[model samples]
Target: MKNLPLSINTLSKIIGKNCIYVDKTKMAYQLICQPGAFFLSRPRRFGKSLFIDTLKEIFEGNQELFKGLYIHDKWDWSQKFPVIKIDFSDGTLKNSERLDKRIYEILYDNADNLQIKLNLNRDIPGTFGELIRLSDKKYGNKTVVLVDEYDKPILDNIENSKVAAEMREGLKNLYSVLKGQDAHLQFVFMTGVTKFSKVSLFSGVNQLTDITLNTQYSTICGYTHGDMERQFSEHLDNVQWEKLKYWYNGYKWLGNTNVYNPYDILLFIHNRMLYRNYWFETGNPTFLVKLFQKNRYFLPSLENLVVTEEIIDSFDIEKINPLTLLFQSGYLTVEKTFTRRQRLMFQLKIPNFEVKIALHDHFINAYTDLVNEKIGLQDNLYDCLEQGDVRGMVQVIKRLFASIPWRNFTNNDLADYEGYYASVLYAFFSSLDAEIIPEDITNHGQADMTVKLANHVYVMEIKVVDNANIDDINGDDVNVIQHNNSALKQIQAKGYAEKYRGIKGITVHEVGLVFSTTLKNLLNQ
Candidate 1:
């Protein structure tokens, strides 16, 4: 078998080095055939850069690289366009001043590469337009502009909204030239991780078609199941195909086929087909975790969350939707799409098992102070539930909550709410891969959580109480004990376990966890 192209994104290098290059030229040809200005948004490391490089080679008339590829025989070899490429993937541009400087440098370098001289005194936007016009005039062909990581500057400072907005406006000043210089451009394709609203980023550019959700281009960036079987067949011999798919596959973009992340596939093969969170480790989602905590987001709602098209289509800096950020970041993907009330709706969920584990692990780490002890605790929780030891599970959970650093509860009102406690439980259970339903709905009411194992089902409810009076002589009159017991009572009263109890070979366990803010741990029985 040919060598795996581990992290080798350049199309020519993959072809020259005889690395395994999945043939994406067919889709590339389709994209370039009638391109005015196209935009594609995919998660980071999902092969957008490599796809951009492929388009660059195709437009530059690198026919030898395409000798056996799909576009070799069909594409016109004689017609070569002067390709002006702009890539923002190198490093972070933290502010608009630096962003403008980078744009100027890129334009000058492109001009130098194309052997065209540009007036250095003009502003970045003017220089960019001049470079396009001059490249076309010099080469006697309209320029093909391929912008990779087009929104990196903005995304780099997304946490700092002020700087991010400045970067956005600076990018807007540069990109707005595209529409005015439309006559000089043959094709313009820009790829980025997230799509800002057209008015926010694209400015006057209205013709730029967003092919992100277009079904035709859905498989353009990722590896389909057929791709893995056909291209990496030799590398995948004797591998557990089902487990591999469970860990790394299931990224969908409203297409019929769900594709595997290319990064995961490459690393999986290189590591001798071991299953791991290869893609998730490349970038940290600390911001997302903190955002989750800040918003007090419902963790269980991620399982079957339904969103409208408008919510996920464009991101606004002023109001960052946690769900939109999660969806766009590849932590979640479209499980299915359907029409509701004449409006298109999408149901999103965790893409695969790898994400399901790694994401929650990160959350658990951020939620508590037990850094090195996280795995041990998770394993303990898993063993307790696997053996139907409710007491053992309760003890393990108490340890989980008790381990949280006091600093986490100091500055925020997180300690006073049920969501904070329930969210922590949700993360711990979710990390263990127990079949979890948060806010589990039943005929009677919604339980805080429902966990399904092989033969045991855990129906749980959580309550947070200020039980400081439990130590007083007349604490019983304050009803602290009654309040603490009501958590379990609610589960039993609502018949939350009724549906699972009748199932054959299923043992339903009702668990009530009452937490005391003063104790910062489970309430005393």
Candidate 2:
């Protein structure tokens, strides 16, 4: 209940900033025991930077920050160690020589602080090994090395293979410096969003414990339930709890740990708004748009996906493999992991809703044809729900998908495309969520679309029009509406509409759309 202070160096000083110094009293303990070398991987903005900052304070022996906090009285903060923090959050490797220059600059900067100006020329290894040997003369204690965002280079050019590989190699060279300096390094902690093979960076640096999967340190990166309960309980009512969960609570750490996104959670509680995809824009993002497009991924039912290891284990950067990357990076998490016997097997669900629609806005961009419709999807569907117009709602979707550039999708892919379109619609109907079944089974068998909002259920039949599905149907049935008698019969025989029989108000609408056509063409047909 005590107030936080505002000093930059003192954790206590971070007052009025929603500062959460989760009694890392245990950090002091951890430092005493496993103080040798450590590495952590979590998604960006999950508090890796803040963790390092806190360590800097602790190691500096700033007892002021610890006042009344767990480490204050418990620690023998009597000794402050010399710290050398290397932040890779901004540095990059574009050219071979430039990377070396950046490496030399980092070494030179740290060395200059100790007043040891040496000639950092071409011949020096410039590895962490060489730097530590040079710094040992000036500082009494072994250095505490903190490298943040260590994978920025690799992330930057995931789309550009040549550049990504170049960056990877350069970073590998720079990290090579860390090897063999174990003698001079008292503590080493590196943080990244990836758990990349150590062979990529530290080939010789083994025995570096990966604390990422370690449940004990799970709260070390993001806000835990207890942290929120203890620190943010009062602010809970400020925003819709369901919306909060829908947007940010999907990430899981350890086995059972449910963690909230520190970035979104803080901004949400801090600003008190339920806005869309905020963090994605602020950072350098290549986006999962292409990935979604390639996988023919739907925006609505992504949350319900139970991914196989084949689907989730690996992905290419340009592909935006959301399953792999999101889970690996933290946007999506192991909501549940199924195992057989004692061996690890497959399948994962979206840990929660916070990340369900992370790809929504990204999809809009990827589908080039979908830009300019800034409709948050959540808003429009809810608008129709409030009006209780089942027919109008179906018409809205009919018109929505009808406007897309369908050339990108084939006839068979129409249902899949419409699934995403409906999912977007579902997102808008946030308030009436329980009613809408994304891939609902209706009287027609499986309705390509069935939306139940505001106690009204609508059964929809969507057929894709192209040279293939439509032209042939036109030839067979001669019906202007559904094409062939076969098409109409299939809809009737399957009983796709039967499922919606008693759901309050029921409406049936059949719509056939040509997505790639222009507005003029769409309006005419």
Candidate 3:
């Protein structure tokens, strides 16, 4: 087997080094056939930069690189376009001024590479347009522009809205030049982790077609199962194929195929097939988790989310939808698409086991004060549930709820709402990679949550009561509460566990939890 190429994204470098190349030139040829501005959105490290580099090589007429590739005999080798490549994948742009400086540097580098002298005195926008025109004029060919991580400047400051908006406008100025330079451009392709609304960032370049959801080029970036079986079979001989797929392969784009994240695949093999959260560890989703916590997002809803196209399409700096951010950032993926009332809707879900575990683990950090101690508690909780020790599970969970710092509840309305507790439970269970259904629908009613483990299924109902209303009952027997229309009584009365009772080899367990706002912990379990 050839070298994995690891983090090497340069097309020429990979080919020259005899590394494992997935051969995306066919898609590149197809994309280049259409001469127009285009945009693609994909999660970071999903081979977007490599795809951009592939396009760059193809347009630069590097015919030798295509010797064994699909586009070798298909393209005109003599005609090479002046390639102007812009990459924002490196470093952070704190404000508009820093962004402009980076743009100037990029333009200078491109001009120097093409051996064209740039007029330093021109404004940033003028300088950009001049670079395009001069490149076209000097090379006797229209420029083919390719941009990678076009939104990184903005995304780098997403936690700070003001700086992010400033970065947006700054990029808008640079990208705006693309529209006027359209006459001198042969092809344009820009890729990023997130897609900003046209009105917000691409108003001037409105003609750019967004192929983010286009099925034809859905496999343009990322590795498919076929790519693995054909290219990396040697490296994966000892690995369990199904286990590997379960951990890393489920990302979809409403296309015929689902692809695995290349980074995960490379590292999984590099690390001796140890199934760790390699790709996820590279990113910090603290902001995303904070957003979820602030919004009190129901954790289990992510398992089976249904949203309209507009919801997942694009977001502006003025309004960032957590769901869109999640989907665009690789935390969530499209499971399927269906039409609802003449509008397209998508069913989104956590892509695979790695994400389901890592994402919810992050959520747990944001929801509770367990911090680094969560692993032990999680193990204890899992053990209890695995052994069907309902009482032990409740005690572990009570410890979990009790671990939350007082400040999380002080002068806050979190304890008054049952969602806080449910969200916590959902995160804990999901972090274990258990199948969890929030608001589980049954014939009688919707259970607060349903947790499905190896052979045990837990049907849970949660009730929140202000401590002031039950002051006298604080130290009373929890069983007494169970007898008086308690959460468990509600489950028993409504028959929430009936749906899972008859499943072969599955034992259904009903559990009820009562939380006290004043006590800031479970009063009964």
Candidate 4:
């Protein structure tokens, strides 16, 4: 115990963030093993702070604590420095007016810790550069800087629209002070959740060496497969390691893929709990809400997704793209990736249970596509469809669409309004746990939808009715009749019937759903 070092506090599950603190002997001495000012961007609660603390212990020359760790032998233990760690997360300034004061507070705290005398009074020296000079003179060593959560304020106000812009500009100026004082700064490492513009922080002295994408450092901030095995081996079963991998792992950076979310995973094992949607409960996105305002239905994009590589890799936050939103927010991950011209060209998907349901809920709350009558619309629709009454289905569907909150279904936001109706109906039936596959690819063509009930399989197609003036082409029109006939023909032509060829006493029916506000209308003969 005498040689163990005070690791108890750092090892606690709840407070220490259930972080295994995967010993990074290689990264512990970034100065010797690597070069340049370091920066890392990981999703929220992914162990950025713990990594920063490890840096503090290593660089402050606390060698006894790191025995058997990565840098214990490689680092010169006796080299101590005037460590001035200023975390941007604590900054409380309203704007640029208090930037100098915040920097001074950081200086005062560091000076007090090192027992260094410094004339920090406004009368003697008030600016950040002045405090740095006094702190250096008080202690004969260079300063090692660590900045954490450097983008919190900007993210917090990102939704206000007006204040968000002002906050960004303010942070830009405050961080600009680091330019001239580069000489006094011995080693600097910054950790934050997102990568905002470096023009704001680096301010042209020495560029931020964005190790966020560098393969060597990609696993530096977040835990890798090996990190999981080595440190938390005791909790392997606790983490449901294999299941955990299915959910939180798949993030790719630089050339390498496969990393885990330390936050959700650690908390999962620490609490020893199994539940639904833990990560989404941690933080809500105002940007996502704003995006929903623009893309109300998300009908087309979500329904027919065929992502190209450029959209996946170059996605930006402000644009409010859903695929990019899911990727960065830790909902979806790159299952596979390809490269062309030395750049990543494509990536596949694999969704975890945590994300699959949240996205479904996101769709529901973000858009009011449902007709909202609550008038037993389901009871009526189900009764009509079950009876195979084509005329009855058409009348009911027309009434339902007329009740639709048409204002919610706007232009590009809803590329396929007909698809929206299908999804809503699917959701209504989903609670019953009936197998519902929309536009199921068939040998013939995409079947609009196929609901497999206890005894029967119903194939249905839906179309939109924009105005009542097109009444002559009502649900009884031949096109409606011919469409259902053609569907039946194709269903038979492509051997959709052959595949299910001959099962024990099974019935197949073709149904046409003409969606409108008049009634829930369907046609079958």
Candidate 5:
């Protein structure tokens, strides 16, 4: 089997070294054939940088590299254009001054590579504009500008609003120069993980087309199912194909073909077809986790987040929605999209098992008191469920709640309602990577949570009673054991497990949990 292109982001290197290359040249060709600036937004590690590099090589008239690709015979490689590529993934830009310094260094490097000299005293925007004109003049052809990770400067400081705004303005000024240099540009392409509003990034560049959700380029950056099977056919032995798809595939922008995370697949094949959370493990989403904690985002609601096109496209530093951030950052993907009354609407979901597990694991660690021992506890919980040890499972959950620091409850509004505990249960069960559902709908009503094991289905309903609420009940009737029994009775009375009544070999486990605000423990199980 050929070697996987693990962490390789250069198109020329991949093609020249005979690495596994999914032919996205058709899409690349289509993109450049049109005469306009373009922007594509995809998650990190989704081949955006490689795609940009491919465009650079193509426009630089490296026809030898295109020997067997789709665009080899189709592209007009006779005339090469001057390419000015800038990548923002190199350094940290904490403030506006740093952003300016980085941009100046990049512009200097580009000029140096192209053998052009520029005025040293000018600012970044001026230097950038001069570089474009000089490159165009030197080569006697229009320039092709490629900006990779275009939003990195602002994104780097997103957690700090004051600095992030400064970076945004600095980038905005630099990008605004592109509008004026349109006459000297043949084509311009900018790729990033998030889509900041054009007003902030592109400002006067109204001609720039955003193809982030355009169905035509949906498969541009990631590998489709066909691409995977065909490109990596030699590595298929000893690999679970269906499980591979379940773990890494299902990222969709539009159309029928779901794109797999390229980083996951590359690492999977490189590691001898092992399945793991390769993509999510590479970067820590501490900022996103902090956002979730601050917003008190209901963790379970991420499965079916409904939003409109405007919401997805309306991502700015000032108005960051957790759902939008998740979707654009590749943690979540569009599960379904449709037009409702002529307005486009979408339902977003975690893309696949890799994301589902990794995200919830991080969420559980951040939202709950479980820290270093979460993995061990999760493993024990999994074993309990597999062995049908309901009491063991209850003990695990009780221990989890016991670990929560009292201060967390005081600060979080989630402790005020039953759904808060339900959300915790959902995150915990989901971290196990089982076929679990939150707020599972049944014939009578919605169960708090449901877990479908190989031969068993666990239906759970959780109820939380604050100390103040317990005071309303009679002194003799308001015991924790009574509330627990009431919970079990409600589950049976409402026929929560009736949906699986006639299932052939599957046993249904109906679970009832009641927590007391005063006791801070599981009142009943």
Candidate 6:
């Protein structure tokens, strides 16, 4: 087997060191051949830095590195331009003063590389402007500017509004210099995870073309299906291809083809093809969890959330939508898009198994008081489902509800609705990485949830009883036992389990759960 370029980000190093590389030079050449500046927004660990380094090598006229690449003959080797690269992903930038110092240091390093001296008594914008003009003058060619993680400074302080705003202004001041130095610039590319408005970040640079959702370049930063088959065929042996696609593929922009997560693929291959949450485990979603809790977002709705193009693209510090943040941050992707009366609409969902399982794990932690016990609960739940123990599953669920503090139910409005219980149950099953379908549809009606195991199918119906609406049976109120029985009867009456009857070698199990507003524990099972 060939060596994988797992940690390599520099184009020259990958090419010179004989590492495996997916050919993206043709797309890179096409991007540079176009006119005007460009901006691409993709999630982190999506090969943006490697692409930036490839552009750097191309503009610096490193023709030897392109020997076996598509851009070898297409690009002109004699016409080399001076390159100015800036990477904001390096160290922490907590305040405005640190941001200014970092920009000046980068500019000074570029000037030194081109054998030019810059005046030390200027602000960041002034120093940057001088560096661009001087580099162009010395190299006798228009300079190419490439910036990586341009939004990191602001994103680092996103939780703090005042600090984030200050960082945004500092970056805006530095970027505003690009407009005046356009005369000496040949090409410019800026990449980041989030897309702040042009008026906020790129203030006066009005000519920037955002190709974030442009169909033509949608596969610019990821591996397509053809890429995996052709470039990575050597590692396909003994690997479950369908499961690989299900876990890592399905990330789409506007193109017909879906893209796979490069980081996950590399780690999967390196670890002897053992499937795991490689990329999702690398970062914590604390901010996202806080946002969801603060906004009281319905977690189940994330599977098929609808929004307009304007809503997804309109991200600012003053008004941040959790859905938009989730979409831009790669937790959710566009499952479908359509035009409704001249307005573009999208249906977004969790991208793949890796995201679906990991995100819900965090959601379970944030929603319930079982912070340290969630993993054990998830394991027990998975074991019970695998063993076809309906009674054990019911007991586990009862324990889950009993663990919730009393204040959680009374203080939050979400607890008043039946959907809240269903959502929590969905999160529990989903965290185990089970094949779950919420609101599973059948010819007769919709089931609350369905869990599919290897040899069994679990069809569940949940009912929430109001304290005031208890029925009187034989002069006594109908207890939780009757309500639970009613739920199971309704499932059978609607033929919810009949839909799976045709499948061979699978046993179908029916479960009915009822919760009373007055009683937090499981009233019926």
Give me the candidate number with maximum lDDT: 3
Q: Using lDDT as the measure, what is the rank order of every candidate, best first?
A: 3, 1, 6, 5, 2, 4
The C-alpha local distance difference test score for the whole of candidate 5 amounts to 0.83
Against the true structure, what is every candidate's RMSD?
Answer: 2.6, 5.4, 1.5, 6.8, 3.0, 3.6
Identify the candidate with maximal TM-score: 3
The residue-by-residue lDDT of candidate 6 on 1-525, one tens digit each, is: 566898889987787778888888998898888546899999889999999999999989999998889999999889889999999989889999999889888888888888889999988888999999998898898989999999999989989989999999998998888899999999999999998876677777777888888898889988998888888889877667889999899999987889998999899888988888998897668888889878767666775588998767748887788888888889988888998898899988888999998889888877786788888888888899899998799889988887877877666665556777877788888777677777779999988888886688999888777673334212233354445466787898999999888788888998877776766555666
Q: For model 6, name the residue pairs that clash.
A: none
Model 4 local distance difference test score? 0.57
* TM-score result, candidate 3: 0.97
The 10-residue segment with the lowest total lDDT in model 3: 467-476
For model 6, the stretches where C-alpha displacement exceeds 4 angstroms are 383-390, 405-414, 417-419, 434-480, 483-512, 517-519
What ranges in model 3 sit over 4 Å off?
A: 468-481
User: Over the stretch 1-525, how does candidate 3's per-residue lDDT look in tens digits?
Assistant: 699889999998998898999988887888888688899999989999899888888888888888888999999888889999999988878989889989999999999999999887999899999999999999899999999999999989999999999999999999999999989999999999999998999998998999999998888879999999999999999779999999999999989799999999999999999999999999999999888877878777887799998989999988889999999999999999999899999999889999999988888888887788899999998898888888799889888887888888876799898888888898899888788888989888899999988899999999988644455345457566566437898899999999888889988899988888887777766
Q: All models: lDDT? A: 0.87, 0.58, 0.89, 0.57, 0.83, 0.84
Off by over 4 Å in 5: 410-414, 442-444, 468-486
Candidate 3 vs candidate 4, lDDT winner: 3
Candidate 4 vs. true structure, TM-score: 0.70
Over 1-525, each residue of candidate 5 has an lDDT whose tens digit, in order, gives 566788899977887677888888899999899667999999999999989999999999999988889999998888889899989998787877777778888899999999999999898778999999999999998999999999988888889988898888888888888899999999999999998887766776778899988988889889988987788888776677789899999999976779988888888877877778899998778889889877777777775578898877747788788778888888888888888899989988889999998888888877786788788889888888887888789889888888888877785466666766777777888888778777788778887778876677898888777763444332345345445455677788889889987899888888888777775657666
Candidate 2 wrong stretches, greater than 4 Å: 1-20, 25-28, 78-80, 91-96, 115-119, 122-127, 134-141, 199-206, 233-248, 272-277, 284-286, 295-301, 307-320, 345-358, 374-394, 405-525
Across residues 150-197, which tens digit of lDDT does each residue of candidate 4 receive? 767666665664555566665565455566666666667777666554
Each model's total of backbone clashes: 0, 31, 0, 26, 0, 0
Q: After superposition, how far is residue 254 of candidate 6 from its true place, in Å?
A: 1.9
